[model samples]
Target: MVALYGALFLSAFLAATILPVSSEVVLAGLIVAGRGDPGLLLMVATVGNTLGSVVNWVLGRGIDSLRNRRWFPVTPDRYEQASRIFRRFGEWTLLFAWLPVVGDAFTIAAGAARVNLGVFVALVAIGKAARYAVIVAGGLWAMA
Candidate 1:
């Protein structure tokens, strides 16, 4: 059980970063196999994901060369959109910051823009926790 959760934590945490991977599939498999505890699973998933996001935040803050990539040229439209989001949402973006593709980018942008790392982490944790909680709860409910 511990091994399963650790694998889940690492897998989910890593997947949430800029790297392309997903733990939800593995989570579903575990739920299907009836392995481990549901509550603990959620906790592990959330913690792992939050930690990964923090790493991404650190990277984003330090790496000032993303714009050099072909995929990431400095465009006024993007900057304007990010600016508006930052201006209006401020720290609230962290709540929805777990939503699929957008979530990863949101966190990175928060770091690149030098947004308060603490607030960014807090909000992301809130969202990440809720996401895993919902998934685990749903899986348990369905199994029941």
Candidate 2:
């Protein structure tokens, strides 16, 4: 059970970075296995996921001055778009951050765009927490 939680932590963290991975899928499996209480599992997964996102934000924050350097995968233009979306949507984007492919990119983009660290972390936490809650609820409902 703890291993599954740790996997979610590692997977979510790495996935938030440039690497391609799906912690959510693993979460689903763990839920099905009844490894942990659904609520607790969701909370752990969400926190792990959000922490991973912060890494990307920190990366972007570091690059605040130079924009996207040639070596980096992100570009200034993409960063601008992220900043605009974040400004318009504010914390809302975190809700959608759990989305399949887009979720990971959104996290990285948040950093590249240099969204506020505190707000960014909070939003990601909310978004991921919501996602896990929904998943657990649905899983329980289905089992019922």
TM-score of each: 0.83, 0.76
lDDT of 1 by residue, 1-144 (tens): 678888998898878765666877777667767898777777788888888887767655754666446544224355456546766777687787677756766666677778787888789989988877777777877788
Q: Candidate 1: misplaced stretches above 4 Å?
A: 69-83
Best by TM-score: 1
Clashes found in each candidate (C-alpha, N, C closer than 3 A)? 0, 0
Q: What lDDT is obtained when candidate 1 is compared to the true structure?
A: 0.73
lDDT of 2 by residue, 1-144 (tens): 678678888887776666677777777777777777787778777887788777666666566564446644355565566557666876577667766645555666677666777877777888778777887877777666
Q: What are the lDDT scores of the predictions, listed in order?
A: 0.73, 0.70
Candidate 2 total steric clashes: 0
Clashing pairs in 1: none
List candidate 2 segments past 4 Å from native.
Answer: 64-80, 100-115
Q: How close is candidate 2 to the true structure, as a TM-score?
A: 0.76
Best by lDDT: 1
